[model samples]
Structure formats: structure tokens, C-alpha cells
Target chain A: MPLGDETIVLSRRQAEIGFAILAGLAGFVILFGAMEHDTGWSRSGPEAGYFPFRLGMLLMAASGVILLRVLLQRGPSEPFLSWGAAKKLLAFLLPLIGFVLLIGPVGLYLAGAAYLFVAIGLIGRVPWLKSGLIAVLVPVFLFIAFEYAFKAPLPKGPLGPLFGLI
Target chain B: MVENFTQLMQGFAVSLSAYHIALMMAGVMFGLVVGVMPGLGAPNGVSLLLPLTFTMEPVSAVILLTSMYWGALIGGSTTSILFNIPGEPSSIATTFDGYPMAKRGEATKALTFAFLSSGFGALFGVVVVTLLASSITKFALLFSPVEYFLVFVLAFASFIAFGAGSPLKTIVSILIGLALASVGMDTISGSMRLTYDIPELIRGISFLVVVIGLFGLGELLETMQNPYAAKAVTTRLDWAEVFRSAMIWPRHYASLLRSAIIGCWMGIAPGGPTAASFMSYGIGKRMSRNGANFGKGEPDGLVSAETADQAAGSAAMLPMLALGLPSSATAAVLLGGLLIWGITPGPTLFREKPEFVWGLISSMYLANVVAVIMALATVPLFARMMQVPFSITGPIIAMICVIGAWTVAGAPFDLWLLMVFGVVGFVMKALDYPLAPLVLGMVLGDRMEDAFRQSMLLSGGKFSAFLGSPLAVVISSLIALCILVAVMGAVRRRA
Candidate 1:
């Protein structure tokens, strides 16, 4: 039941307030964008902005209510995320972010392999040999399955030209 | 009725090919894996497989998808019984009694009962769909733009009335979904609405990418906060125990029937399988003769929950097909798939594509049978797979999600979008905001807008256009009633 090492990084109340404010900002942006066009009922019918304009208002109103309720209510401030949990999340997420960044330059196959190797070996603390095996095998399997069987081409980056996969 | 039967016979001809049967088996197998894993689910599983079905015939594609759904429903119960972990949200109720039964060395019996009752409930649900398909389609054909818009309102209202969340938060979630859906080109006025001058925004945010980020990567991130160390109870399948469990089915016939009916009603009303299973379990505890021993490894409790879960899962298809209203997130994803295939879901679908409609229905019958057999045969395999550490499985799943998002439109921008939605999904779950309404809104937003505009055009731009017909009046009143009930309930709880 212990989710983390028990040092609270953010409280539930703070997170709620922050999110509500962000939503309000998003609502304002939507409204601002919506007003670029005619937000009215023309002779033809309701204009395009008419629907989105009302939607923006409704979003702002809903978030405002949420913000007000959270502010007015008095309660215990539970931990939203602990330091340990945050560290764990970052460990998983950072590599994923790297994988996404790597996808554009190295293609899906190589980036995927590199991601699997690091994630499994370093973060997961698995044995290097097994991690290397999985890193190599999975992408190969995906390559054959996607390229040959399904014929849905995935991004291969430099590897595509080198292997004549493109 | 005779005509319906004849069409169904023709549907059998379309779906009964050897190739289609193989697809069912493969889909079910994949579904079981997805269902057994705690993070992966039917919605994620279906979305991941959606791109693969792009080349397939609609009937074959749907059969594959529906078959995977049946397999996931059945697979979800396996983890609940063996590991006391519900793989799918709908199967959470099964753990109340299923885990206890497994602990008492009746794992085989518990699993058999769960699978058999699931099959029974699914069969019951399909029978209901078969009988009511024509009538529902007929009723839907009478709808005008007013009625269609009202139906959308009714769907949202029912979510608020029945949702186990704060109404304000649910509204915010729904509004966000609608706002996101309106981002691309405006179909009605032939102008851009909310693109914000971004090139990627012109195509709009793909719901498939949203789904991949939200349910797929979002679940992985959440699961990482507290990883599951699965301690599975080892049990080999015994034929004698299975036969014994099958023989006792008649004793719990009333519970099974009652739960199936509850499930069907909930499915059609948009309460969905998670709610249906819990409702059936609670009601079964009150009504059963074994009520005294309800939660302590009671067979009737397991039966009630599993039956209702599968029943609702199958029965939810009716609304999605007949009215273009998906009652669950997975069904919403399927609705998205239908649109991708250029087949508009509604009453006209029945008239124009009898083979497609009937083929899907008939395949349900075949898929559930295949699901039961496959679920039983592969229990040990999945149970072993569950023993793999989350660290390894987690990365693999994340990789799969990345690939899935990329495949949607092969846009790198979607990968970024996927990341943003993942964060949103995790935060929303932590805050107890319902995700299903958001998904429902995203799927139906454009259509709802069109219905509203068309209604305005029809009624000469009057706000009173919604109540122009008696059917519209009834729907509007129902929406009002749902909101009233929710308000009164909230007030009473506060007081």
C-alpha cells in the first residue's frame, strides 16, 4: 500500500487548483480563438464559431465552478505524488520521451531497439545479456511482422536505406 | 421476424468462412493477452489492432475486433481468480468472490464457473440483440435532426445521472473532448474553426492517437507508481471439476438470468459493463438464497458478476450500431473504426448493409464460443505470462503504444499529442474524472454539432426546435429528469 518513500512533492489541493487554473486558461484561449470568426446566427444558420464560442463559455464556467469549490472547501491535503513515485515515473517517462525524439532521426526500428535496451537493462535492472537479446529480437520481429506480413511500413531511418527496407 | 431470420442466415454465410474463423481465434488470443495484462485493456487492444484491419473487409475486420473483445472479457476474469487482480475494469467485481474461491483450492472450479457463466451471459445478450435489432433500427429510422440531437443530449445526461463522479468534473471532461473534436476543418460552414494556425491542427487531433496516449501510455505511467507483484495461484485444469461446475449451472439459473437482464439494460442505457457487474453483484447478494455466504468464495457471486460483465460488454454493441451511440470506451473506439472504414453507423446501415450487420451479429455467437474454449485452454499460458515483471512488460507496452500512435496517420506530431494526452489521462484518473464521457464526446462531437445545426436550419433558427416533436419532447423531458435526479441526489448526499 505504500506508494512511495513518503515525501510529498505536491498535495491534492494544490494539484486540483493548478489543473483548474490551467483549464480556465485553455478555456480563455479557446474563446479568444473562437471570436476570430463570426460567432452569431446568420441568415444561413448558426455560424461555425457559434458552437465553439458557447463550448468555450461552458468550459470556462465548469472549470470556474471546480476552482471555486476546491477553494471554498476545507479538507485534508493528501499527497498527490511522493518523491519516490515521481522518481519512478521520471525513470519510465524520460526514456519514453527520448524514444519519441529518437524516432524522427533514427527511425522506429533503431529507436525502439535502443529504448528497449536502456529501459530494460538500466531502469529495469535486468541482466545485460537478456536485455540485449530482447532489444535485438523484438525489433527484428516487428520489422518482419510489419514490413513483410502486414505491409504497413514503419519509419526505419538510416537503417531503412542501409538495409534496403525502404 | 421471418425476414430478420432470413437476413441472419445470409449473415452466417458471410461470416462462417474458414478465413473468418481463423481471424476470430487470432483476435481472441490477442485479446486474452491484452486482458490478462493489468495495464493493457480492450480499448487499447482494439486501437492497436485497428491499423492492421485497414486492408480487411469490413465484416472480417469487425469480426476480428469483436472476437478480441469477447476474448478480453473472458481473459479479464482469469487474473481476478488467480492473482486477485482484475485485468479489465469490468472484472473488478469478480475478485470479490473469485479470488477467495481460488484460495480455497477451487481455482479450476472458480475459473470454469466464471467462463461458463460469461458464455451464458454473452449468449443471452446476443439473443436479445438478435430479437431487438430490427425493432431498434425501425425506431431509429423515425428520428429527425431534433430527435438525433436529443439522443446525444440523452446520452450525456445519462452519463451525469449514473456516473459515480462529481458532475462538474464530468462536464469539464466532456467539454474538453468536444473542444478537442472541433479543432480541425469545419464541415458545415466550409471554414477552419480552431486550428490555431498549426499545420497538424488542420487535420484535427485523431481520437485514435488520443486513445493510445490516454488508455495505453497513461495506464502504464499510473501502473508504474505502484507496480503489481503478481503471485498467481497454480492450478491445472481438471476435466472432472469443469464437468462438475457445468452440471451445477441449473442451480444458479435465476441469478444468471437476473444478472443478464440487468446487464442488457445497463448496456443499452450506457451504464456499461463495469457498472453492470457491480450492480449485478450487489443485487445478487441481496436476492440469492446463499446471501449469507455471499462474499466468502460464493459461486453465485462470481457467476452474477462475470455473467453481467460479459453480458453488458456484448449488449453495448446494439446502441453503437443502431444509433451511432457507443455505450463504452471500447465501443466508442469501434465506432471510430466504422467511420474510418467510411461506413456511417445508424439505421441506414441495416438497410444498406445487411451482410455487414448480420455478419457481425452471427460472428458474436461464434466468437463467444471460441472465446470460452480459448480462455480455458490458454489459462496457464496467460497466467505464466502474468508472472513476467512489470518493468519488462511496461517498456514493451510503451513501445507498442508509440508504434500505434505513429501508425494512426504516420504523423510524428501525433506522438507528441500522445505524450500530452498521457499526462492528461494520468492526472484525470488521479482526480477521479471519468474518461468515458470524454471519449464519448470526442467520438460524437462533430455529429452532434451537425445535428444541432441541421435542427436549427429545419426549425428556422429557433431554440425551441428541440421540442418540436412529441418524441423530442419525451427525450427532452428524460434529459431534464436525469439532471433533476442527479441534482437531488447530490443535495441529499451533502445534507
Candidate 2:
């Protein structure tokens, strides 16, 4: 439950470098747009982009300082993400992305049921019958609750008519 | 004052009807389910329900939504006690002590105390709203762009005051949020700033989608991935112990009162419940005779977090009611609901439609009382959920997140944004950056920008006019001091 060493895999320095670079790049992008929109004061005073422009520059400088601090620090460091935690994160998150992608073509209801069955029966290693039942029932419940009770229709794919009773 | 009280009593007459009570109960129950679920929180719950409000009366709609808000805050602590996973960000502090109590086989005691303290806090918040109703109305009616802008600045400054992260990180996070907020077409000039020629990007990033991803999916990804993180399920349901704790809670009156006041101030100031929770708990731990006893299953710590969270959640309505300003994400969604219902929330709301405003204020009290009773009755049912396998629970959460994101705009693009922010949330968490400020920034960012531009236009481009108002001067000075202190502290630590 705690974010302890067990979850830490990357060295502190590596994580710091990665975050700093990302932030610094984002800052540069922001600054670029801000400058293009006229970041300086105008005839009326500060322009639309004026405040954001300064904010972007500050982000870059602050991130640079952060990178420096991490580099210079001599104290002992902890790993950012442990190996086991990394595997778990990827295993859980990657399949979730796949499920989300399938929603467009497969429909939310169909994709959700399939995702549930596979995630529960296969990845979770639960009994097939129970997982199948849950996979079927939850979508049905959501259909009734959302489509009928609330009258807020969810995304319907090709197979949407299969559960139109609700 | 007497007239407002009489009107408030009439408001209560409206709220106490059987039909309204049933709605309140349903709202509370739904809110609890949303809160007990790991992937949903107050903002997500309210936004998801916004669609259903279209057909209902404005009073019933506000009552339902606000009761759900109350239920969500109370339900948030349940998971914190049982699973060491905060159902909402504000309950993160509760996990510090509540989980320890659960581990010690006092799950019912912790739940009882948390629910009761939360109820008390809600009452305190309602009392404040009742007493300050006229004054708040006056303030709202009189406030110019200058006062309102200062209030927004105070909201922005709060992130720094409340954030424990490095000032640079906070600033960077806020800037990113502000930049993201600017992505949609500019409301003022109708000029697109960062849409990148994408049709879907025209609406900019929906705060609802971004939040569902950041808090809901991001949290699911974290604990669901790590099997080792799961603890042995604790399922003690002793009514006697709970009753005893409830009976004894009033003895800790000092902490209860102090935390209530702290929560009220934070809620009013736009500091949000998370900050209030942390601040209240910190103060409780410091002032308690059992200071070192905290984080070791201490009751007072749980009380502090619970009380402050609810107090702040309830009191957060003040700004929304008085000024149409939302202090938190949930409040923002509630404001959105108000707009949808064609009920403009401002000073005139009091004079023009006392029934709507007073009805809402009265229902808040009833909702808190009802939420506590509902929460107590259903604690066993919710506790059973914590024992359910994550395999089943995890997918359900993902489905809910996807459904919530998809339904908000009924746009598939929101699902994509949800996915993107989920990863963004993961990375931010992996790097120890706080997510609350980012959320606050996103919600307050556009408003702050608009306020600034308006102030600029009003001043006719004179930046000094920002300093012309005493209120603005005070708030701006506060922000300056916050940055200066943060910088000085960093330098001192380095030296």
C-alpha cells in the first residue's frame, strides 16, 4: 500500500533526468507558441500571451535547476520503480489500452464485456463461469442504469442491438 | 437575519418531504457507491450525474447532486480504512491512521468515528453558510472585477501555500495545466491558440475526462498492477465498538472544532478539501497529547481527516452559491449543473429566488444527516466490497472510468484524452509530483486567465491598476511572500 522500495525500480537520478527533460521540453513548446502570439507588452499593456510566456520560461529554468540538484546530490537514492512493479504496471495498463482501442470498433458494451472476461478469467485466473457471468451482468446493469434509468446512451458499436432490451 | 432564518425554515419544509427524502437517500447511496469505488470521486460522480439533471426541477437536481457530493466525501474514507487506498484524494490523510485502525481489528470503530466526525463537520459548514448567507450575498452583489480577480488570485496562490512539493514543481504543474486549458479556442477573441488543426481539440481538454484519467485510471493502474500491495482483507463489523466510539467522539471536541474551522477557511479560500484534510491532520497530530500516537492507528487523526474533508466539501458551496465561483473540482461540476438548470448562482439568486438558494442550504444539513445514517447502515455492505477480488473490481473500475469519460461529452475523443492523462498521471505519480495542484490549476486556470485579461482591459493596460485594489494588493503580496519563502527555504536547506 505504501510507495516503498518494492515499487522503486529506476535509480533516483534516472527518474529525475527523465522528468526534467520532459518538463523542459514542454516549457520550450509553450514558450514557442507564446512568443509567436506576442509575449511582450503591447500598446494596451501585456498581451494575451504575455503571462503564459513568462510562465513557460519559468518552467524551463526551474526544471533545469531540478536536473542540476539531482546530479549534484550525494545522498543515497531510492529506485523509482522496482522490476516486479514495472511488470505489473505494464501488464495491467497495456491491456487496458488495448481494450480502450477496441471500444471504437467493438462498442463500449461489447468491448467492456470482453475486457472483463479476459481480464478476470485469463489474467486474474478466476473461474471461467463466474467471470463470464460477471462479464455479462455488469454490462447489462450498466446498460439498464445508464441507457434506461438515466437515458444517457453510451457508445453503441456494430453489436449494440444485441442488448437493446434495456 | 431573522428573515433568512424564517426562509431557511420554509426551505426545510420543502426539503423534508417524502419524495425529496427518497431522492436524498438515492443520491447518498449512489454517492457512496461512487466513493467506495476506487476509480471514482466527488467530481467524477457529480459530472456523471449532470446529464440526469436536465429533466428534473432545479431544486431537486441541486439536492440530488449535492447529497451525492456529501455521500461521496463520506464514502471516500471507507476504502482508506479498509484497503489503505484512498477512494478520493482528500481521504489520503485518512489512510494514514484509518488503515492502521482497521489492521488492528477496529474497522467498525474507525468507520463510525469517521462518519460521525464527517457529519459533525458538515453541520458546522451548514451553520456557517446559514449565518453568513446575507453577508455573502452582499459581498457577491458588491464585488467588482477587482475583488473577484483578487479572489481568483487567492485561489491560485493557495496551491503554493498548501503544496508541500517544491515550488518549481508546483509552478510547472500549474503552468502545464494553464497551457492545456488554453488549447481550445479563446473565448474572448475567438482565436485558436493550441488546437493544432484537430477538430476534436476544438473544445480543448475536458476537465472531466482529464480528472477521470488522472485520479481514477491512474490510481487503478498503480495498485491493481502490484499484487504484493494487496493486504489481508479486514472485515470486523462490531456494532458495540462502533457505538462506543461514537459515544466517545465528542470528548475530542477540541480537535473537532479546530478542524472544522480550518476546513471552513480552506473551503472558502479555494484551498480545496485535500489541503484542508492534510492541514487539519497535521494540526491534530501536533496538538494532541497523543502526538506520537498518530499514524499508529490513532482515532484523532482519522477524525481530523474525516471532519475536515466533509467540512471543506460542504463549505465549498459557499463560493459557488455566492459568487458562481467553484472552489474545487466537484464544486465546478456543481456549478456546471447550475448553469445547465438555467439557475444562475450569484447575489441575486438570494433576493430573486430565496427558495432555490435557501432550499439548497437547508438540504445540505438534511443531506449530511441522511448521509451519515445511510453510511452507517451500509458500512457492512461497503466493507464487503473491499474484500472483493481486485481482478473483478479492477475491470469494473476501468469500465466505469471509460463510461464516465465517454458519457461526459458523448465524444469518443474524450476516451483518448482519458487514456493520455492516465499515462500522464502515472508518470507524475512515479516522479512524486502532487496531482491535486494540477487539478486545481486546470479548474481555476481559465478563470484566472480571464480575470487577468479582464483586469487588464479594465485598467486599460495599466498593470498598476491590479495593485490599485487593497484586496488585490493583499493577495498579490501573499503570493509573492509564498514564493520568496519557498525560495529562501530551498536555499537554506541546500546551504
Candidate 3:
């Protein structure tokens, strides 16, 4: 399981704590919303928040139990993954996230092309000739498939108009 | 029963049209591609195509989606055999014998046998669906609102008890799903509860975000970390050998039937294909003379896994068609597709839109045959696809994931939700929590809410009235029994 890199072990406790915190936060939001909206029964029937209010309480209780169990349990801590593996995952994830974020301003086609080029050329270390060809072709292929066949609209930057050989 | 048969035959006529047939092929092809590739799965793949189907006929659309479903199930076995990687969760058991067979240069034999068994299992499940459709509809009609509510409870309880591991974790995942389902404006009183005045939250979390993020992005992240070994596979397919393999498959006829039976029952009962495949494989191993060879390339092992996997896959659609209840993640997505098509799937659906229901069933039959043939013929094609570097595939998959999320609402905010849910999906996977229940919960949450609310109104808001009907009593008792067992298990563990 070693990936030939420095690694830090992530215990079950740390993961459980994070999950419990998430549950607690969700519980608080739901509880507050239920209270604000009123979970009481009206003349017709139950209020909108009635069932969710109870559900929120159950969620909070479950989180409490999880927190308590993690605190009490002495579980074995195993190596989660190597730093290299983690970096590999984050490498793709962060770039993809960035790609999505960039799509808003740079447009889908341009953003997509840039993401592919960089991920393949820089991150993957693939040859420029191969990566460059795929980068150019993919967005073009998508443009035809979605825009022409499906008649779907994609986000566009100023350069998007140039592809209007359509 | 005779009338149902006649209608199904008529449905064949409707679905056999050149246009619908083409759509079926397209659907199956799309399903196969995604099912073979890592990261993208049947549910997300179907969801990606769902928005495009708005202009198509409901019958054509449903046929296409269901065809994709069948193809995905068929496609998963191919990946399992050739690459030792299960493209779908249900195919995990196949890897034990399938990969071993491939390693021993029996890849063609194993693939042929698995495909044949899968086809046989699917056909058997479809026959069961066809014969039992009317009767099942009758049974479902007995359900009142209270009974409907209790049925959902029984489903959730069944998953929590029988899912992969840790009932408590399953419960937590289901609760997380239910909680997320409550984020949008409450439909009952027109009050936004969990939105916290955020306009984006008003529509609530889209299940598409959760599904694509979990199965698509999360799986991609997983693959990047724990990459599968790229093993060499023999792509030689000999007709004589394939025929010999098929001929000898009858030796496990009993196992095949038993697996199909197990698969169909589990599929209908909500255990789903993964559980059904494992159960069938386990039983086959116990019964076989070469039980010791189960994991080392036994043909019976391959047959048992494939048969049950395909059978359970096809049968999982039964509840969705009959009671509007989805038994699997892909089925849930199909359910969402149905809702979008403005078709309320219940007992009345068959009575109202007989053509659509029967056509879909008939298309299932055709799609099963088509998918098996296509899979067998294209094994080499998929084998090559297996060798394509994930570096190239990964970015393409990411792009598609982006398009899927963006197309859902045509908003940047939805992409952010997709990313958020992607991280949540990754964490959940690491935590060993069963995710199927979460997706199912979100899909059924709205329907369950309506049933619970209406039942309260009908009973004058009295909780005791839930036990009035015999059907309701039965379902409630079932739920109570499950909870009791869970509690007893907990108490025993504490001691």
C-alpha cells in the first residue's frame, strides 16, 4: 500500500469527528429553520416543518452518539494512503474544481481546452503532440455533439463567437 | 394473465419500430461505454442524458433509459472479466472468478459464459415481471397512505439491516440523505425551512449533484489513488471454444435457476443486485463440487455471479414500475426521469398508459438480447478500451461531469454544489457508509412526505390511525420488527 512517499496516517477518529461536526451543523440549521417556520399543527394539518423538525432532532442525536462513540472507542489507526496518492487525488480534484470555477468567465470550451492541455501536458507528463491534439479535438467534438446534435447551449466567452462556423 | 401477454406482444410491435430500435441501441451503447469506463456509472450516465430526453416521447425516453440500464449491467461483467475491475458495484463478485479465468487465458470462455448467463438471467427476470405485473399491481392497490409510508420505512430498515456493513453507519447515511432532502422550500406550506434565505438553496440539493459527485467524481478520486493494475488479457475468441463453454454451462443449470430465483426475489425485496450477486455466488460455491476453486476460476462461480447479477438488475425495476418505488440507485434516477416526464408511476400507470408500460417491458426483452450480443461481439473493443490511459480518460470524465452538473440547472451555483457533494461523497466512501440508501432516501423523500402528510390529514392528525388498515398494520409491524432486531443487536453488543 506504500506509494514511495512520506505519509501521515489518518485515524478513524479524525474522520468520525469531521462527520460528526457536519451532522451537528446540519442539525442546527434544520432545527433553527424548523423553529422559525413553526412545526405546530394548524387547522388544516401539520405545519411544513413538522416532520423535518423531528428529523433534525434525530440527526442531532445521531451526531451526538457518533461523537460519543468515537471518543470512547480505541480503534486501530491504519495508514490511509501515501502522500503521493493524496497528492495525485488532490491534483486532479483541485484542477477540476478550478476548471469548473474558470468556466464562468472563460467559457466552457476555452476553459475545458486549457484544463485538458495542462492536466495532460504538465500533470500527466504526456507528450505535447498527443496532449495538444486531444485538447483541441475534445472541445470541438463537444461543441458539435451538444450544440449541433442536442441543440444545447454552453457558456461562452468572447472567443466563443469565433467557433460559429456553424 | 392472458391479457397481459397479449398487451406485451403488442408492445413488441410498438417498440420494434425503426426509430425506437435505434434509440434502444443508442441507449445500450451509451450505457456500455460508461459502465466499462471507470468513474462514470449507470445512474450518473443516465442522469446526464435525462435532460436531453425532454423533447422525446415518454415511451421512447423510458425505453432508452431502461435499455441503458440493461446495457450497464451487461457491460459491468465485461470489465470484471477483462480488467478485474468491476465497473458497477453489482459486478464485484464476478471479479473473483472472472479475473482468475482471464489470468489463466480463459478470458473468452469466461466472458462468453458470463454474457450468456447474464442474458438468461435477464430473460427469466423479465418473464417474472411480465407474469407478476398484474398481480403485483393488485397487491400494491391495497396500500393506503399509511401503508405507503410504512412501506418506505420497511425499505429503509431493510437496507440498514442488510447493507454492506455497520447498520448504524447505514442509518446515519440514510438520515443524512433525508436531512438533505429537507433543504428546499417545504411544499406543504410554501415555507422555506432549510434555505436560510439563500436563493440557491430554495430549490434544495439536487440528487443529480449527489449522484454524479459520488459515483462520478468520488470514484475518479478513488481511482487516482488506488489505481488498478493494467493486466494483459488474451483477446482470442474461438467459436468452437465458446460453443463448448456454452454447452458445458448447462452443467450448472440448477445453479443458474437458483441464482436467478435468488436474484429476482432479492431484486424485488430491495436487497439489490450487489447483495443478490454475492448471495448467489456464496450459495453456488457451497453447492459446487469445485467449491474450493470458487475464487480460482470456476465456471460455476462465473455463471452464478452473472446470472444473479443480471436477474437482480432487471427485477429491481419491478417496484419502480408497480409502486413508484425505486429499488436501486439507477432505478431511482429512472424514477426521477419518470417524474420529469410527468408520468406518475403507480398501479394506475399500467391501467392508464398500458402502451408505455408494456412497450418498456417488451423493450427490456429486446435490449437484453441486444446487449448480450453486442457485449460478446465487442469484447475486444472493450478490452482495448481498458488499456486507454486514465490520464486521458480522467479529464474527459471530469469534463462530462461538469457538463452534467451545469446542464441540470444551467447555473454556476449547481457546479459548486456538485463539488461540495463530491467531497462529501469521498468522505462517506472512506467512512464505509453505504451510499445507496442515501440516494434512495433522497429520491423517495418527497413521496414519503406526501404520504405521511396526507395520512395525517385523513386521520384527523391522529397518530393512532396509522395502524387502522390491515395493510398499514402489516407494514408497520414489519418496520417495528426490523427496529426491534436492530435494538436487540445493539443491546447484545453492549453486553
Angstrom error of the Cα, residue B255, model 1: value is: 0.8
Model with the higher TM-score, candidate 1 or 3: 1
Instruction: Estimate every model's Cα lDDT from 0 to 1.
Output: 0.91, 0.81, 0.85
Give all TM-scores, in the order shown.
Answer: 0.98, 0.90, 0.97
Residues B393-490, model 1: lDDT tens digits: 99999999999888888999999999999889998889988888988889999999999998998899998978878889999999999999889988
TM-score of 1: 0.98
Using DockQ, give the best candidate's number. Answer: 1
Q: Say which prediction, candidate 1 or candidate 3, comes out ahead on DockQ.
A: 1
lDDT of 3 by residue, B333-357 (tens): 8887898889998898989999999
Stretches of candidate 3 exceeding 4 Å from the true structure: A1-4, B488-495
- TM-score of the A chain in model 1: 0.93
The top-ranked prediction according to TM-score is 1
Q: Under CAPRI classification, how is model 3 graded?
A: medium
Tens digit of lDDT per residue, candidate 2, span B1-495?
A: 897799899899888889888889999998998888766677777766766677899999999999999999999888888888787888999999999988888888888999999999999999998889888888677666666677766665666655666766776677777777777766665666666568998887877788788877887777665532444346556878878888898988988999999999888877778889999999999998777889999998988888998899889888888887777778877876786688877788889888888888999998999999998888778878766778878888888888888877788788888888887887787677767667666766666677777777788877787678766687678767766777777678768
Write down the lDDT that model 3 would get.
0.85
Considering only chain B, report the TM-score of each candidate against the true chain B: 0.99, 0.91, 0.97
Model with the higher lDDT, candidate 1 or 3: 1
Error of 3 at B260 (Å): 0.4
